[model samples]
Target chain A: MDVRTRNNVVVTGREDGPALLLAHGFGCDQNLWRLVTPILAERFRVVLFDYVGSGRSDLTAWRPQRYSRLDGYAEDVLEICRALDLRDVVFVGHSVSAMVGVLATIAEPDRFAKLVLVTPSPRYVDDGDYRGGFSQADIDELLESLESNYLGWSAAMAPVIMGNPDRPELGRELQNAFCRTDPAIARVFARTTFLADNRADLPKVPVPTLAIECAQDVIAPPEVGRYVCDQIPGCRLVTLDATGHCPQLSAPEATAEAIAGFVES
Target chain B: MSGLEQDAEDLYENAPCGYVSTLPDGTIIRINGTLLTWLGYTRDDLVGRRRFADLLTVGGRIYHETHYAPLLAMQGSISGIALELRAADGAKLPVLVSSTVKDTKVIRTVVFDARDRRTYEQELLRARRQAERLAGTLQQTLLPPSLADVPGLRIASHYHPASTDQVGGDFYDLFPLADDRWAFFLGDVSGKGAAAAVVTSLTRYTMRASAVHNPDPVAVLRDLNAVLNREYAGADRRFATVLTGLLVPDGDGFAVTMATGGHPPALLISADGSAEYQHIPGGQLVGPLRDAHFASIDLRLRPGDTLLLYTDGLTEARTAHGRYNEQALREYVLTRELTTAPALVEELTRLLAGFGEGLDDDTALLALSVPPA
Candidate 1:
């Protein structure tokens, strides 16, 4: 296998163990997976990387139009799999990255063995026939708030995004971290993460899948998580008593345990 | 503290409005004669007998404790907030309140009659509601009663207004042209509200009329552009991005001939789950020039293929950190394997709804799918 040293893709672990690839979601870089890495490091060849346009990745590789779609993200995933030349790999993706894993697996089913999707949502809109917990009007209000005051909206939306507005400091921390992102890239990424609906692609995923549902998560509620599992063939749904969007941040031990169980099984 | 003897003190006791003083915890420490009279209570009935919150209406009390009191404590003073007092007759008296925290940990709350300002605000709200209703009704009329039904196709369209009280410039129409052709256009006029509504109405009417006379998509846009340029070119300098397409039924499918005036490309999702955006280059803004150039693109819609027409609202929608551009649309459409038009439009609408709050402009979506024979 020809290995390409693209930015943000870090491969480190005992080469003798099973291969596991860890991916983070939007508004965060690879550091988010840090808490869970050491726990898994003992048994698996843990591969970690930032998605393009995030963290210490090659900023010059960022293309506004190309990165605007999640498929480009899936492309990077496949590239990482090719570069690492790993077989029977367990792919773990958080938040929107979970959907990215689905797309990537669909693109190259032979490259991956199993997928562990954390808080995955195929659709976020409510229709007459379907419910994703939000209405078009609600999205409009959120967009307007974002445009009217980007910084203030980020600060206010942080707690909501973090799933606890009462913890003002958490909201502040999220805002500060989110503000570190390039405004233009962040805006495009925001659109891509929220706007694209991959409900139709769920059925096409051929690999064994595990949908890790967060019990108290407002971002990916129980109903939506169950719906996602129902759509994917031969997929198991496990609900963890995690509160926020980032379970690795709120309940790292439970999250790690779940992954460990899934991988062992 | 003899106040020019007791005679002069009597004048202050009889003054209008209410006054009360309380400790930091809201325990009543003092009450004046005027406030006592208004509540039909004597000095003994109020002073040290009840908290200042007791005289307020239920909502007023809640507001005072939750917002007013806390704000006052944090800021040392709060003023000019409206509140309601429970009067002697069990009626509510509207009043403006100002509160200050003193060094003694006592809070002095001064109340003033706000009947005039209250009345003015009520009238203002009523007028605003009336204006909003008018705009809503007018905007409703600007849209087609229903999109014209075409044979061999399943269609569904949705229009999201930006503001309830004001109409936006985005508009879409699906109508039949003479001789078995259907012309549909989705466009966004510059600016928003009433002025944009006028342009939207005119564009919709003009497109229909122009299509009746010339059955070609490019010709219809050209003629509409001339009219809009003539009408709105001078002081307003209004323009719009429009995509007009003519659908003609072919063998088990329809041939879509579309012309673009700086509009986003239409998405075509084939039966096998492959999707691509119809590239129409050199499409300039309509109504900006006397002779604005427009580009037309042609595509053969096969059985189980879906064509989606939309305004820039979809592409420009904000995501987590970026705009929902053509690339995302391509990725989404490519993965879905949409077999019908309703499926295509349904997914598009779902995508738009997901972008929620990030989609600032008014969005209009129209989808046409050729059924499998």
Candidate 2:
């Protein structure tokens, strides 16, 4: 498979400079990195891609069983690396992809140099004394809401999501085009994102990592951020003065600066 | 000012839809009186004290941050997002909200009450689920749970349902006849749902009754065609395609006599590993015409030979290579070198599954073979 087309891989920025793989998380596509790319592009080569079932990525390549777990997403990241033959790469991941990056680096340690986890969470639902912020019931309620949202908005075309990528011209006419996702595939991604328990895998990360948490994010709270930073050896922490789960969109310049600073340092 | 028109302040405060303006960080800087009344909150209680997301339920908050907020940021505006907000008494208020950025990305959001829409959608979903369940049960009743085990022959059959909400029009059955001969028929009705099922059930019983009386392949099809044409001759003319046959026991094999009425050609796999389709010429459809010519063909299924009958769903499947038509199926049968009836049925069943989203219709398969001597 041509991983570029499969993952909708887009490469930009200084070509000769070091490569930075920016992986967007659940809910949005690689367009989430639009604001940050211009800043990061000045010094580093920026690479953006949508996960297989998200955005312009080939939806036909998506298989439920393979993508139900985080391992499947990690394979997509690793495959893109091999396809581009990228080495000593700086892997930047957001939301659930932060854990995906950890898994990817652990699989191919020699290929990646550093890791930057944005609004990262190793787990969303709490277990034992762990303060993952939300409970199992909360996650269940979220899933139910997600289901209803699909029915309300995209239910008409939900049945035809397979093998049908929205035309580029059609995306131009729709206001919510960038976040256009197949409802069923998005549900699987949400299940994989919100219910995943990657706390055990954090310490397994090999390279120096930067845990960029938001000072006020309900999805990935300060506790989860500190937990991830504390777990991984040589992992540092940076809490942005931001709200919500996506700092790149909320505070684009600040986000870009942090990414560039970390990569250069 | 005229008595017919209201001032801007009155219009903004008492509009049908709720409007709230927020700062870049979602602080509720301005809210209309209509929304304030709906949520049972006063201006002092909400403005500058809460963010737009704070008024939402926890799940809605997650959705807002994950989907709604990012979309608004990327697109400069987002509309018709379904979310629930918590009222003062903790009752959930379902609403559809549209937001756009203006003046340094301060969010301007409009919320519409969606109680009736949500209720209607839930009812529609419930009705859909009930219809799917009914279709599933009805389809099960149409098919025989187990084929009758005939002596000296291996018989395997499989039914692949293309949808859960609507029953397929295709059906098949195998049963006994006089003199210990077995009679079997496969047919595809041209309609769907209960109407098609009625025609399908009628065709199956008529074929069986006709064969029991005459036991001739051509006669059975002719009777079915006449019965359907007579019963549904008006505006709702229902038609069907069938391949009905009788299996007469021969020396170490079965002499299969079959007739086709516009149905797809059935493939015959010989004992020597060769495969070919049975083409009975001049066979028209089973219904609609005043008089249709039905043709019959005879085949001797020797030991280790198999005969496969399937609906057009198999041939019409869209695959990676191309449309999986009859030629592809025949090539698949020959090249795969499948030896027995059960094995071929199982492999074809797997093939149907491999078609995945490409298989667009309900399919039925029936394979019969004489045990290897």
Candidate 3:
């Protein structure tokens, strides 16, 4: 399989500048980084991609045996990096993507220069003292009859999904998904992300890392951010004055600036 | 429209549906009486105090932040999203929501009660599953538990249902007639589900009863055609492509005499594995027509020779370029050198699996061979 086509890899910005590969979290695709991409692209070579089961990436390539684990998603990240031959890269991951980035960086430490984890949680369900912010029941509720049915994903999103103005060919592309999400795939991804235990993998990070948290995030609270920073050696923490799990969407400018500051430093 | 326009404020505040307006970031900015009454929340409690997402249940909140919010920003509108909200008393209220971006900073939304609809949908889903289960059970009862053990011939059969949820139209059976003669038949009904299952049941039984009455292949098919025509001769008449045959041990091999009613011909593989289709020219469809012509072919299955009978589902399955025609199946059988009955059926079953989604129709295959004795 063509790795670039399988992941829907989109490369933009200065070719000579350092590479910054952005990976999105669950419940979305590569479109999650659209708001912040333009800002980060000015000085860095940016890469954006959708996970196999999410967004416009080929749904045919997704299998429950492969994508039912975070390791499967981590493989997607590593494959994209290898496909582009990207080296000394700045990796930015949002929500669950942060854990995915951590696994990828651990697998191929030489490919990455810096790791920027945006509103990430190594584990979502609460364990004893380590609060992942959600109960086991809450994750179950999200998985049960997951709400986003791509066939029923509303006619309003058609224009954006059919032929996005920014890239008209995306509509013509196979499995064209801008914002629409398949519920079956979403359920698997949700299970993989929420039930994962990547806290053990955090301490093994081999690069400069930044854990950016939101001031008031229900998904990943400030303490979880602090815990992430304290776990990884020499990792920095920054909390943007933003709410919601997705800072890239809720607070794009601050999210972009924080990422740029870390990447350029 | 004019009357409603005259009382626009009253209608907006007290319409059958709840209407609210929120900021681009989902902060509740405006609310109406009906919605406040539904949630038992005052303007002071919701507006400027909580965002639209904050009012939703935990799962709904996650769905909103991840999917609803991003799509709304990208598309400027969203519709008919099912979610639940916590009423002031903490009871969950199921609702269908549609929101449109009224301006750069404002998103107007309408929320409709979906309590009854959700219950109905769940009931429908449960009932559908039950029906499918019953159909599967009924389908199994229509086929023989195992192909009857003919003393001199080796036999294997495979059945594939396109979907597990609904009963398919394809069926096959093999049994013995009196006087050391064995009877076998394979056929496909036009439609699927419980209705086609009825036809399948009738066809299987009718073929059995007809063959017992007269083991002659053409006579048996003619009797079936007459029974089907007499029973289902209405405007929306049903039809079936049936193949019935009798096997007789002929000293060193089995003499196979089979008749077809608008069905694909059986493929005969010689001992050396040269495969070709048996031509049954001008076999008319069963049912509808008062009198339908049946075609018969007589062949001998010598040592190491096999005969394969299948429904159109096999020949009509789609390939990347077009339908998988009979010629392809012949070439596949010849190249693979499939001469044994069990080997032919098993390999063909594997081929059917390769069709995947393209195999939309049910398929039935029955292979019989005279092994070296």
Candidate 4:
């Protein structure tokens, strides 16, 4: 399908409960949240949509200059909330989407009630005072890899996402899914996701916040997750004993259970 | 075999390129056609007598046993690879060859003429060098012959292009506004190459023209934004991250009102060795939409305070082990306490040199420091 036709707002589940907005991160679209959505649908209104540059999203709206920064994606989240008139909404953002949620909440604090950040990182580049887990060289290599061979990057990155070489099928599946994205948008998103430094906005998040971390996640480790929670006020950190970056993919039942309890509490 | 069949086999053994068949240990069992012809040998001279290594140039033989042979044995086959063959005349013929173990007892090999490809590759290398030289000349033409020298402030600037062949989008300029006020800006246009260079030129000219009528930093940025949006909207969109400021001399230093359009924060280094980034929040990108909002920050530069403006290239430079981050730059400035424009530029240039190729983007640095009066 063309990218413009892909941009869609899908509302699923019961209409009576609190509304929940689900945002996927860099590589995957709303499909990443597939397993967890059904459980949330039983008790809450689950809203899922592809970001403008992503799957089934409007390619016409995907301006490279605008989407080059994470704040552009954050603006889309706020716009989506405003369109739905979603108040006291619980925003669950995965990977870089977590940082996007932070920026969106900072832009309009009244619209969001809580932010659930899944495998989120404000800054991936490590500083002497802060341990962002990856060095500048690591990110540079990633950018180089992306530029040299987009398909090769997906192939190389899939194993890291799978978290195990023994699970070759999982790596194959992840690579196949990542290959579905347009090369141009994927390149822009890759640059935007790895290059942003949103740590400054962490403390400005006034709403309740929860950072969900995957214990074995190479992308967003547990320590980084704790760092995020520590930066935001009155924020809680939870670690799932999942092996991959996408906990909602690896352990959906546990991930959904954690979110449901956190929101209810 | 009959005399007629043997004569037919002799023709196959004697074709122009050197050919050899050996056991898995590389002991020659058969040598063929032009290989025997070139090697000054006959069928009776080489059959089951010579090793394949005996036919290689000394260096080629050494490399073959050390790397090529072991690799080929492990991989089952190796091909079209460069190697030198030793001619009977003791001269080396640069050739490409393919070798594979046909069986545990024998190896099959084929040799082809590669003098043409090697010559072609050399010519290509020379042409690439010429193209790179021409690209360097074109890239320099994209930058101003020199940054406009504004009076009153000791101004020194530097523009470092990431690649000579492709022009980068980083640019900076200082010019006069009405009422004795001076307007200056440093910005990075999105993307690179000739297309980005065009946008960089457009932005610099638009900013200069807009400031003549509207000296306010915010207003000037708005005008530029309007022009850019009008020119580069829709499918052919282009945008820039810019920091524009109005410098009015106050006391000894200048009182500056800076507006940012999704650019990095400006660094204010005081004479007392204190340096801080002028943080402007919510500065949207310019030229994506018709009405893009830019944020402005006000800071009074005291005597001995030097304001350093730069593109993202500097902060995003990758180090050998890590990135040359904002914190590192801040700490570097704090330690030096640079009070003059020249001193700041010198230090920054040194830092850029240390970054080397890691700083793979155009970097523009403009520093304005007011001396104590």
Candidate 5:
């Protein structure tokens, strides 16, 4: 399948404008950028896409071996860049996507001009001395949450399932799309995202980066934001007044301005 | 305050569920009397002194931060979240929490006592896990625990299941017949799970019975075909592809008589390292049609020569280029140049494992050969 179609790519704004790619975190899709994309699109060529297993992306292509590690998602980002022939791009990644952007930049630094990491953490599970704001026990609980919360997800996804004329044959297909991910895929992705330790990859980011830390994000605490900023060479740390893990949804203007300032400067 | 304010306070305090309002960081701003009573805490012990997360166990606290807080922040509301709240006397209180963002600063939560619901969900989960375990055990019991030990011959087999969640259709067995003769068959019944399991057991038993009644390879398959065709004649028709054989002493090695019923041809690897398929053509699937055809072939197994039988799962596996069909299997066999039955089966098992997620169907394999003296 075409990479664009596989990732459910959407492009808007000026064709010749410098490209600004937006990548969302786990439990979300490209739609997380709905508020921030409009403002960024006014001045830059905005590109948005879901990960292969999330949103409208093809679920059939979700191979357990491929998505077993974060590198598969990093490969997808590189593919998107090559498919669009985007160069010197500004990548704005939120939550787990922040690490994905880190991986992509490490893979092809020439393709990215700068990076904006919002509420980002290089690692979630804490190491011996480094506090990533969560422990191994915490991630396990989160996985349990993912498993048990499917009831609400299935109920919300009922419309998509009912929209099909044939119920029996398409039942499995609808179950996969209800939470924008198949339950099996979600479990793997959750494990991959939360248990990831990308601290070693921090130094390899060849492009300048902006670490947009929310003031009150429990997921990625301030210490983590500082550690990420300290690890990347010439990485700027911007503490947004926003109080949630999703600064884009809760504080879009600040998120947009941070990206704009970094790109223009 | 209005004159109706006294009743409003009474209702808030004595509501069916506990109500607690907290800051975005879970600092308790105000909590009703019902919740304080449930947790065995006074209003003074909570108000301005503790956070909502402080009342939860360590696991619950972690869940609150990692999932509950993030979801509430992202989705604006999260309802019916199961959690355990720690009480003043070190007791655990199971509760269902529903929280909504009142504004940017405040989070309003309603908590319901869920002891009975927790017990019920545990019972259901336990029952489901038990059923799956039982299904797995039942499927294992149907297959032979060990292949028959025949003198002057080597044997090996393996079964690959696509899913542990359900029983697969593939089956194989080797058992001694009367008068120093051994009977063996490898087949795949239609469908999966308990139903396929039933048909596979039936097919295995019928093959054994037919071999005892008359050990002719052709006659054995004919008997199986008649039994299946008669039993599954109506709607929900069942069918199978089988390769049945009898092994008897031929000097130092064994003479083999094999029959096929809509199954793939068996592979023969010679002592000289040449491998080829012994295709028994014109064989029709057993069970669906009354006139199902069975064809037989006779072959001599020289010392260091091996015979291999497998289901379609090995041949029909998907690959990056295309299907790994019969031609690919033939090429694979030729390159291996296996000398013994165990060696051939072991090598094939490794190759199949390399297929990883691509091998989406159940596969069964059996190999029989004579040892070089």
Candidate 6:
């Protein structure tokens, strides 16, 4: 398989510098790193790409059996590193991609030099003796909401009077294009993400790691981040004052500064 | 404050859908009466007391924080998001919400009461699931209950459905004919669901009826082809690929005469630890054509020799290594020291299970072998 086309890989920055691979999370694509990529690009060869089922990657490569588990995504990461001949690379992952990076790094520790995780959660559902925050019922409702949302989007194809009329085109674009994921792929991805249990895989990281937890994050709470830090050996935990799940988007400067400090040190 | 015909109070208080304005963190700031009434809440109960996420069920809250909130933060607006709200009295209220961030601070949400819509969708889902169950049950009645055990042969068969929701076209049966002779056939129809099921039931009964009159494998298929062509040779014409065989006890084994109608070649494993495909070349698809010809091959099944007939679903199943084509199947069987029919069928069942999601089609396997006496 052509790794570049399959993953929609975009490589920039100086060729002589070390490589920084950025993996996006569930909702958006590689564009999630739009704010942080420029800052990192000045010092490193920035690599940004989308998972096969998301963004502009080749959707035909999505096979349910292959992508049923997180290992398939890890294989993509390893394959990307192999294709670019990237050695001792710094891997930066957001949301569920953090766990994806953990799996990849564990599989081949020599390839990744440093790890940066943004709002990462090893498990979403609360198990015994662990507060992963959400429950199994909540994940099921999330799936139901996705189905209902997909139904609304598809059923309202013939332009209805829903949102503001002043910026009708913006409303239309939101209904038609923005954050548009294939309903089937999105459902499977949601199940794979929210239902996954990677707590056991967290302690296996062999490289220096950084866990950035956002304040008041409803998805990955601060406690989950601390748990990740405590499990992994010699890992540093940084809690951002930025609210919401995405610190990279809400407060890119601080997020980039935190990442820059880790990479430089 | 404006004296215009469409005043701010008129729009906010009596909009078609429920409107709620909240802080960036989903804390309720100002809400409309329509939303308050739908949730059985007073103004003081929600306005400053609760965030928007707090009103949702455990699941909806997670979806709101993870998917909805993130999208609103990134894109500044999200439309037509379906979520369930927990009412004041613990009832579930399904709502379609559209929210937008104003100046990257306040969040203005428009919620549509989707109780009726949700009910209709649920009904549709229920009806679809019911239809799938009915189709599945009907599909089961088309095949034989059990393969009758012949004195000289050890036989076993398996049917694997890629999906339990819809009925597939693959089928197999092994039954007694007359005078200590046994008849067995495995075939796959062209389509799926109820229509294909009708064709399958007809083909099975017709093969049995035709075989009783004329026990020749080729003649039996010819008769079935004639019946199917006469019945369904119209616009919605259905066809089938069948491999029918008649097994008659010879000495310590059986002589098998099998005919193929565009079906996959059967595998013959010899007692000498070798396997080869019994390819029948000039066979045409049964039904859809008036004169579909079939050819029969005669093979002597010696002691410790096994013969396996199957549908194309086995050979055409997609695998990580590529399609499990005839050559791959031949290589797999050639490598295995297959002695009994049951063992070979069990191994093939495991191989099919290994395909997982790649095996999108239904498969039917029927094996007949002479045990080493």
TM-score for chain A, candidates 1 onward in order: 0.86, 0.91, 0.88, 0.88, 0.89, 0.90
- Residue-level lDDT tens digits of model 4 in A1-265: 3322445778898898888999988766777788899999999999998898675675546678889998889878887887778899999999899999999998999998888999888887888888776778767755664564422223333443344557767765754443235556777988898788998899999799988988765567678898899999999998997744677865789999989998899
DockQ of each: 0.02, 0.33, 0.26, 0.01, 0.08, 0.19
* Candidate 2, residue A123: how far the Cα is off, in Å: 1.5
lDDT of 4 at B338: 79
- lDDT by residue for model 5 over A137-181, one digit each (tens)? 867766775676422232333332333434533544533432354
Where does model 1 exceed 4 Å of error?
A1-265, B1-19, B22-27, B32-40, B59-81, B96-112, B232-236, B302-304, B317-324, B328-360, B370-373
Off by over 4 Å in 5: A136-179, B1-6, B22-29, B40-77, B86-92, B100-107, B141-196, B208-218, B226-373
* Model 2 per-residue lDDT tens digits across residues A104-183: 99999999999999999988999998999899998998888777663233533221212123443343335234766777
Backbone clashes, candidate 6? 1
lDDT of 4 by residue, B1-373 (tens): 4765667566666555667787754667877767776666777776877667667764345335423453354445655556666776787666667788775636788776667765775587578778778767766666666665556688888988887667789888887767778898989999998788789888988898888888888998899889889988778889999999998877666788999999989898887778888999988888897888987988887778889999888999997668787888999899876789889998898688657558888899999888765
Question: Which has the higher TM-score value, candidate number 3 or candidate number 6?
Answer: 3
Model 4 CA deviation exceeding 4 Å by range: A1-265, B1-114, B177-180, B319-323, B371-373
Clash counts for all predictions: 22, 0, 0, 8, 0, 1
DockQ of candidate 2 (2 decimals): 0.33
Candidate maximizing DockQ? 2
The parts of candidate 3 lying over 4 Å away from their true place are A14-19, A41-45, A81-90, A145-177, B1-15, B102-104, B142-166, B172-187, B205-238, B242-373
**Per-residue lDDT tens digits of candidate 3, residues B1-373?**
7764788889899899999998756678899999899999999999998889878887877777777777677667666677788889988888878888865758899999989977876687688778878877887887788889999788999999988788889989899999999999998998988888888888888888989999998888888889888878786588899888889989899888989898888998999758878988978899867778888889898998998999988999998879999999998898887768999998888788768678889999999998855
Indicate the residue-level lDDT of B282 in model 2: 83
- TM-score of each candidate? 0.52, 0.81, 0.74, 0.44, 0.69, 0.71
Assess each prediction's global lDDT (C-alpha) against the native: 0.77, 0.87, 0.84, 0.77, 0.83, 0.84
lDDT of 6 at A207: 93
Winner of 3 and 6 under DockQ? 3
Q: What TM-score does prediction 6 earn?
A: 0.71
Model 1 DockQ class: incorrect
